[model samples]
Target: MALFDRYLAGQLLVYFGFFSLVLVAVYWVNRAISLFDSLIAGGSSVITFLEFTALALPNVIYAVLPVSALVATLYGINRLSSDSEMVVAQTTGLSPWRLARPVLAFGLVVALMVSVLGHVLVPLSRTALAERGAELSRDVTARFLKEGEFLHPGRGVTVYVREITPQGELLGLFLQDRRNAAMRTSYTAERAILVRVDGTTRLVMFDGMAQTLQVEDRSLVTTTFQDFAYDLAGLAGGDDGARRRDPREMPTPALLRADAETQAVTRKDVAKLRSEGNVRFSEALFALGLPLLALGFLMLGGYSRFGLWRQILGAVVAAILLKMLANVTETAARDDAALWWTVYIPAILTLALGFALVWRDTRGPHLIRPRGDGAPA
Candidate 1:
């Protein structure tokens, strides 16, 4: 019995890895395209692109694990049935519940892995990723000086550049500042350059005109200047080099505790923090429930040449419905921490359904009445 359990569990683990690798590769490539564009726009090195994509991998893997588990279990079960191995085991006095023991164990293994990622790696990666993004946001040349494009890097500020010289000069630059609703300012320059002086980023606009509009009196004032210096970091608030941390970037313990400092720094209320904390655990718990759920559904069909297509389809639909339920519950929990238990409902339901399905299989095949058309006695 122990040998059989080991064999079954080993098969599941191997298949889980294969499926995870394949799926992660596909998903990661899709993510890499967007990463490439953003990294280039921010004047990041290829190394930075690789680093950002690597940081993003943990979250992608976290998302893909459940799907990989489901597919792996289904594949393992279907293969066992196709080889008549399941029939042999069952005929040798193993009931469906007994056969499911190894699958349950396999699910627990998956659950443990997911728990580690959720509690540790994912948050750390996200925090690192966010820090890198903020650092990129501080590059004035990339954020504000892109040539032949209009950019809005801050609230009520617009900048445009017609061309940029290889010698690092801006030609035909335009700037509009409307942060002060009552008084609007616009600047246009035939040539300009960026200079850093005394730990400050300054834009030197040459041969330009400054136009001010008074909204209250409908009056406009225009003045020409030989050169004008503007403090760019002040415009985008990037001078401070401070970034707000997201709740998801914090450790689970921190989120659950949600001290006054955490709340003030993250700008999230206690209820929402608690709800997010619970969600991480509940989501990790799905790793266990999902595989068992797939195994149970696949077990419903006897060995057949055509395969367990109907059961596989049913498993997919069930997984989708359960995921939808989880999302709905998560949204509700966010509204009030008192509803935090709702997030666990899907995990509970999945486990129950898995057990129920396997037990039903143990009940023997259901009998059906003969068709009336036969009219046999």
Candidate 2:
């Protein structure tokens, strides 16, 4: 019994590992192609491209694990059944439950690993990738700003350069601020240099003229200075450091903390946060449920006399429906707690059906004995 269990486990694990690699490779190629345009736009180096691709692996792995598990299980079981190995084992008094034990154990282990990755590692990787991408964008922008063009640094601010020296200095700099409509402020400089100050980049102008236009009284005040600095608040606002932390980018513990903090917020904000938190929790739990689902699917595949292609088709359809159901339940859970009931119901149904099938297959053939020389009992 122990040897048979080891054989079954080894067969399933080998196939699972192969399919997982294939899925990961396909996803990586697709992502790299999709990111090609962005790479060009960002002027990314080879190292940057490689780093981005590596950072994206967690999301790909999370998406592919369940499907690979299902496919590998189905294939492995079908192969055993087709070769009559399962039949021989059954004749030797190996019950369906006993045969299923190793596969279920394998599934549980995979599920736990996936759960940890989905709940912990995925969020961290996503946050790091986003931050790095933002930094790259900022660096690219600072290097690529052209002369003789009006640039909007960020909201409510505009900068115009009449010319730029070959050495990359601004020859004629003009900046406007309409942040306060009631008091428009404009600065002009004969020469300016962009510099970083206190973790923020600013434009320092030499021999510049300043204008203050007051809309309340239609008044204009002008002043001239030998040296002046314009620290555009808009630039500061554009810093990626100030960006909102998306719930998906937060670990489970941090998400819980955030939910607690937002309890005193407005009702709308509370609903939004609760919705996000519940969905995250559901997805994390779903990773654990996948192996159970895979086991059920494997039983169906193994017992069906339909051709291998048809069984494969059925498994594919089943996987699609399961995913669709999960997504629908997740969407609902975000808006209402009542929807969580829908999430676990499918898992329960699948488990029950799998157990019933396995029981009937293993016991039905032995329950009734030939009676009275093939006559009625």
Candidate 3:
């Protein structure tokens, strides 16, 4: 019995490793294709792209583990049956429950891993990735100033360049500021370079023309200079360097703390925050339930002798329905506290059904149905 359990576990481990690798690769490729444009737009480098993708792996593993477990179990059981191994074991007095024990253990292991990753690793990664994205967006925006295009960095400042080099050196630069209600200023330069000083950026124009429009008399006065500088303090907000933190990016502990702190906050803001927090918690718990669901499906697979493909199809459908049910329950749970009842109902149903099927199968046809005439006795 020990040897049989070890063999079953080994088979499941091997199948799970292979399936996880394949699924991760497929998911990575799909994400890369979908995010290529967004990454480029955000001015993310190869290193940034790799880091972002790596951070997403925890979520992917959580999503894919249950399905992989189901597939592997179905395949493993079908292989045993096709090779007559299951028949031999059955004849040797091995019950269906005994054969399923190892698979259930494997499913439990997967569930633990998913729970840890979903509750801990995923939140950390989400926070770090969001901060990185903000940094990349800032870098991209700073580098996007193009010649012959009016660049409005912020406020009422408009800058235009007749020509610019790859290094961002400007020629024939034009600038306009309409930030003041009483005054408007325009400057033209033969050459300019955008320079950063003391955490603020300024355009240093050389041999420029400057004009001031007086709003009082609608009069314009012009001047030329050998050198000039435009104060760009207002061009961008100083807090642009600050990172935005969404609740989803917060760790579970931090989110819990936040919820506690805001418990008395019953305004719309507090409700929104509470909803987000609950959603994250629910998602983490749902991920943990998936492996148990897979175990239940595996038990179901053991009873069907048609083939691996049929079992796989059934498991897939079951997993999809479980997820859909979870989503519906999660949405309801967010709106009404009483709706939390729906969250664990599917998991309970799955366990009950799986165990019932196993019990009926072990009891044989006579106990499960009428002995001969298909009528209840």
Candidate 4:
């Protein structure tokens, strides 16, 4: 039995790894293209792009674990059945429940992995990702240093640079600020550098001429200087620090214990926080029950020489429906925390169905003993 369990468990894990890696790669490529476009368009460095994608992995892994677990179970069992290995084991008095133990254990392992990702790693990564995004969006040096291109960091603000030196010097810098609408200002500089002052970014231009035009008075004033300071902080929303974390980025404990003040700070009501907390647990349980559900369906009838394709299709459909129900329940829970109990419906229902299948298999069909070697009982 131990050997039997080991064989099945090993097969499941191998299949799970293969499916998970492939699925993650597909998802990663999809996200990477979008992230790459955004980061490159914003003039961010390659290192920053890598960092953002790395931080996004936990969430992706969390999304795919349950589906991977189900596929692994189905593929592993179907292969074993097709090869007659499962039939051999059954002939040795191994009941369906006994054979399913290994699968259940495999599901538990997947559930643990998902729980960690959902409750801890994902939140931390999300927090870091958001902070990094805010930091990048505020980097005026990156925004303004593109050579020979007109860059618009904000509405009514246009910046141009003729050349960027290896020493981080900007040459032939041109900036036009018409954001005030009542007044227009233009600055042309021979050279410029970005300097930080009191947590604000300022472009210190050398040998620059500033021209101002008054809209109402229709008057123009021009000034030439050896050094001038133009505040660049306004280009980045004037915020020097991280933005407030979203409710999904809050740790489970913090979210669960959040008070009215915390809610105000996070801008998430108690219902939202409670729903997130419930979602974490429900997701884990859903991962755990998926294998049970799949196996129970596969075990519906004894092995057929051709295949159990029908049972496999039935299992897939059932899993999809269960997932849909779970999503709907989660949505309802988010609207009203009192509906939180509903989030567990998928797990509970699937587990019950699995158990019922096992019981019916255990009982089998009761056959009456032949009476007096006749057809009549």
- For model 3, name the residue pairs that clash: none
TM-score of each: 0.83, 0.69, 0.69, 0.83
- Lowest lDDT sum, 10 consecutive residues, model 2, at 262-271
Where does the lowest 10-residue lDDT sum fall in candidate 4? 365-374
- Winner of 1 and 4 under lDDT: 4
**Residue 161 error, candidate 1, Å:** 7.7
lDDT of 1 by residue, 218-297 (tens): 89999999999988776635666457789988888888898998898788988788888998888778878888888778
| Native-to-model Cα distance after best TM-score fit, residue 143 in candidate 4, in Å | 3.5
Q: Quote the lDDT for 174 in model 1.
A: 95
Two-way TM-score contest, 3 vs 4, winner: 4
| Candidate 2 local lDDT, 1-377, one digit each (tens) | 99998998889888988999999999889999877656644345677888888888998887787777777787887788789887788789987789778777667666765776678778788888888776765552353246676665454667787887877788788888888879988999999887777766667789999999999998999999999877643454455346566666765654445455444432334444555555554554554444445544444433434545554565567657767877776567556654545655445555555566566655443323344444345
Candidate 2: residue 156 Cα off by (Å): 16
Q: Which pairs clash in model 4?
A: none
Candidate 3, residue 15: lDDT: 90
Error of 4 at 376 (Å): 22
lDDT of 2 at 33: 87
Candidate 3 C-alpha error for residue 216, in Å: 29
Model 4 C-alpha lDDT per residue in residues 1-377, reported as the tens digit of each score = 99999889999999999999999999999999999887766667789899999999999999999999999999999998888898899889998889889988998999999999999999899989888877776887778878998877666888899999999899999999999989999999999999888988899999999999999999999999999988878787677554666887888887777688658768887777888887898899889988888887777754345577877898899888988998888888888868878988988887787777666667642222223444355
CA shift at 40, candidate 1, in angstroms? 2.0
